[model samples]
Target: MSEQALTLKQSGVRWLWVAIVIFFADIGIKLWVMDSMGYGWANRIEVLPFFNLLYVHNYGAAFSFLSDQAGWQRWLFTGIAFGVTALLIYWMSRLPAKEKWNNIAYAMIIGGAVGNVFDRVVHGFVVDYLDFFWGSYHWPAFNLADSAICIGAIMIILDGFRSKKLRTSN
Candidate 1:
């Protein structure tokens, strides 16, 4: 089939399954964590020397940016998620199906964004559980949705450096 003739469904949009899977996984894990774990640093469960499943509520964007605000950040973050998802879906529709890296990256962001959006809308915040620490310092707790978004963003950045021209070996 001609690349130009491909419909949305036959294009990289097909990769949205990755988004769906990510969304469900993010939601399911959050639900499980909410039900199975205690809800704060005091209740953290050590999974390794430097890792813990520590349930937390992030009222802001990544790394809890604006978390201490007077509660306006949630709506802002939700709006941003909607915008990002729309843009990603548009990009995916234009991408060729074989462009797995790009498509998957876009889809990952979509999934993760939507998953977090779901949390923000339904729970008034994002549920975070995975925590990494060292000695007396710690990284902000995050969740699977955050991981997917970060990975997708990294993939997009890395793809920018990929060589587009195929070279014949000497």
Candidate 2:
């Protein structure tokens, strides 16, 4: 086997392992939360004044927007998730194996997307818990999957900024 081919194989194996671990962890947490807490049930084990453990179901995109649609949104979001996940997987595999943070960002996004996709496919909605409030204002409830996606987005942005700074410095 050529050296390039061997490197590619090793990278693919590493990415696969990373992806699997992320995917399974996301799914496993969701499953446990669902089974233990039951759907739309909030335990409210108050850890702070502004936080609560409240489970909510989201039938549409962020903030429950389009949740009341006559119906079509389910399949639309599902298709979008699948397409984006496919692209992320391809990009992740093509990245240099030594770019650890970039690889981490891609894997996180892939895992998060897969987790929400599973929910959309099975229940036609995503289950959200983790809630916060401030005075009269409240933030939308979200789950582990959404958290992962947000973290991934932050990491990607930071990575880009760091790379740009390095280029400019040189």
Best by TM-score: 1
Output the worst ten-in-a-row residue range by lDDT, candidate 2: 10-19
lDDT of 1: 0.92
- The digit string of per-residue lDDT tens for model 2 on 93-118 reads 67777777877887777778788888
lDDT of 1 at 8: 69
CA RMSD per model (angstroms): 3.0, 2.4
TM-score of 2: 0.86
Report how far off residue 102 is in candidate 2 (Å).
0.8
Candidate topping lDDT: 1
Question: Candidate 1 — which residues are off by over 4 angstroms?
Answer: 1-6, 164-170
| Per-prediction tally of clashes | 0, 0
Tell me how many residue pairs clash in candidate 2: 0
